[model samples]
Target: MKPVLLSVLALSGLLSTSCRQTTSQAPSQAEINAIGLKRGSITMCGPAQGQKLGTASFGTSCPAAAQPDFNLALSLLHSFEYDEAEKVFARVIAREPGCAMAYWGVAMCSYHPLWTPPSPAELTKGAKAIALAQRLAGKTNREAAYIRALAAFYQDWNRTEHKVRALRFEQAMAAVHAQYPQDSEATLFYALALDAAADPADKTFVKQKKAGFLLQALYPGQPHHPGILHYLIHTYDYPELARLALPAARQYASVAPSSAHALHMPSHIFTRLGLWDECIASNRAATESARCYAASAGLPGHWDEELHGLDYLTYAYLQQGQNQLARAQWQYLDTIRRVSPVNFKVAYAYAAIPARYVLENRLWQQAAHLPRHPGPLDWQQYPWQAGIIHFTRALGQAHLGQPDSARREVAALRGLHSELVRQKDAYKATQVRIQLLAAEAWTLLAEGKAAAAEQRMRQATDLEDHTEKHPVTPGEVLPARELLADMLLQRHRPQEALAAYEANLIKHPNRLNGLRGAATAAAQSGETAKAARYRKQLRKLAPVAPNPEAAAAHLSSYRRP
Candidate 1:
């Protein structure tokens, strides 16, 4: 019965193609129910309800008894609950002592392909797990093949470069995928490996596009597959491709409602498109979900996932001008810090929340008076997080007519840039340098050196234009180019300021400051037509109160529309 069921599943997978549109008809309820059944009894040979298909199956050569616990473990792995997945996979190993794939699950959790490279400790642990799997008896050829693919990822720690190792693992997965053309899990894992091996400097996103195509094909039959939707959101998490992923982003939370990351994933698209309402709702749900998970697990503090959601929530609230709500979130962040352990996520929020509150509200005096080392988190370890605080302080001090203090921050930023360069972190080095240039420009402007300030600010803006923000933080506290536009407006260069604001809108899209600056610069330049259009957009963004007629009359004077 198991063999027959396996054959039927393979045949069904073979009928699917990689080009099928997401809107194509989905599998029927009966067909889905039959996916993991043998002799009318549900088995754990494949994914069950809410479980993504993993590269493990029960068959003649692999005679380990099917247990629901194994499927639950795979589901947790798909949702990236690494700690939980590791424990559950251990249970599967204890029950089925010869299950080679159980060790594979443990190794995969440590890799964290999308987030960051494995730490040395994680690599050692994964290598040990793979060695154990290799010694297990009765492992099927396919199961051995799966283990071999992951072995390539954890093979050489001190010798091979990280990207070179990733490419090696990708090549192994490609071969596994070819060997089992009808295995949906093989295709899915191959797609992820392709994405993991993609060159970050290649803006064309060739590997990402290929992965997206495979996930799209898998979606028509397995519409609610958590891995497919989650990977799809990640593949298109850029300005140009975000809209194309709206369908997956919109459906993922519903498909895996129990997973906090699943709930949080949709907001990537929402943030990219500036869909503030949707972004707010998604992060709100995600925060609550993360809190509940932490509480149920009896953890001592709020999980990093909760802080991550709050970062997105705060950004959306500020964009919508809900300062009261944003301030409330800022207060909650301090509470979390008091109770939570200091980690990268906590440190990032510790810096970003205050930076956003002061800069977005334009409270220059408060920003200027901020502490040099504000929090207890190790600034030396996470210099990029520290850079946020210094950047804000520099901007505020310069704006408050304190050139000396601002210049001090400029020097500090240069030191930070030099430190990152020594650490061989090119991305953060570039980011800190951009901040240094902006700080210098603002300080020069405070000294009434308009021409020199413009030159420095333009250099900062041009460098910033070529780079994209890292995925770890929601965005920078404030964009440097936007500051350049503000400085241009102050210098009575309305035309250049308008162009700067327009370019910012292309990258940021519907940011409140960008919209407001573009409108004011247009009005000052006597571009009444453009001013009216921008004013109309502003009105749509935030409606005025207590004399709608007066507001309409003021805007009407700009154009005869």
Candidate 2:
């Protein structure tokens, strides 16, 4: 699962940091051939309504196919368009009376964010729906089998215990994948389950390897397949592999402009390659197409799901130093938040806007506050959101000279994994665990335990490396490297710090933090001229003076040594 919070850097920002380029053995033709690539858009056999039902329409009958409104409703529920999806399903229940999918769709859609879950009532309705869908499964066909599998998935999703729900969802998804291996939707959904698992530290490694094997066996050229490139780019730094994937990512985005998954990615690659013009152009095109999608949906009287596009565009703007455009976009996001206020989706808008400003202006204190919430908001309840907030809190507190408070906040966040499992938030719980490992390692580094910290940090990075193959952002990995580099420098391991910083620079050369870290490492290692050169680059990049020693002192203000 790409940490959604990482949208801050995916689009266009350039890191003016260190330079360490290491070449690896080029990918062999056989290795490249193993990446089963899909051509054109994700092909679905259902109906035109099936696509909408699959992607959007869930609640009501929006004229999907002929007989089975329930089937169409099932498709909509799978795509997460719960409101309209639910209405369609309710109609099916009214007519068929015992149609199991209708009840299942109700359950699935009920738990969906579009409808919002405030109390346990929604959970009950979802359970009832799941029971109905299961009962209806007694009499079925190929379509019914597929639908039944989905019903099981949703039922498991709503279970109060996250671990159980995740396992059930995984089982259902696995069944679907086994039965219909060619079903990209099934495969993608299965991947999503892996992405959401509670203890994915190991599972991510296992799943990505599995996904790679499966992708090779089933489809070979669909580089644009949602998660394949994400996995490869993040896990290893094989430039040849990334080069081979370039065409696939580009073609995928071109073919499926409206797909949120497809649009931001090619642009992401472009950003990484320092192709500013290409990144900006792709973002512009994506933003335009997303606008059209929102207009057509006509939900909430505006674009309902284009936050993804807006996020991409925001990153693009920040990277190009088009802060003015980024500010305008932030304002627009604020207006949308005020007018719509749908779910926690707006937190991206709120968090990103200020984060960009803080980063750009070097306002560490302000940035720190943006990520700390007094309590979980509706969206903040997500494991990913909770992780992001906690990380942000750590970052803010660290910058504000409160390492002790930062340590405690991070510890409290680590405790959320247990609660997450209890709350049936398996997907989020797993992600949080990954972050917690990284955060704890950083805390140990701050506490001057270099050897122990490095061990934990490497473990965290290794797990991230194993899973980098699935479709998720590599932001966490970059930060982990940076923290390690800083730790190495503090421990007088300048060579190791330099090596790590250089490696990260290859992946994210424009990151100001990486640049700053390189400069600081150089200075501490007695390489004055090298340090001076990096400092010049850093100043050009961020133009701020952050005295680490002074910052450390400030950290003392918030908590104990």
Best by lDDT: 1
Q: What does candidate 1 score on TM?
A: 0.83
TM-score of each: 0.83, 0.58
**For every candidate structure, what is the RMSD over all alpha carbons to the true structure, in angstroms?**
11.0, 14.9
Candidate 2 lDDT score relative to the true structure: 0.50
Give the top-scoring candidate (TM-score): 1
Count of backbone clashes, every candidate in sequence: 0, 42
Instruction: Residues 313-393, candidate 2: write the lDDT tens digits.
Output: 666565454556766776676555321324444444344444454444345576466643322236535455555656666
Candidate 1 lDDT tens digits, 327-397: 88988877664334456677777778878877777777778876533445668887777787788898888
Q: lDDT for each of the candidates?
A: 0.72, 0.50
Question: CA lDDT of 436 in candidate 2?
Answer: 74
Candidate 1: which stretches are off by over 4 Å?
Answer: 1-67, 338-342, 372-376, 544-561
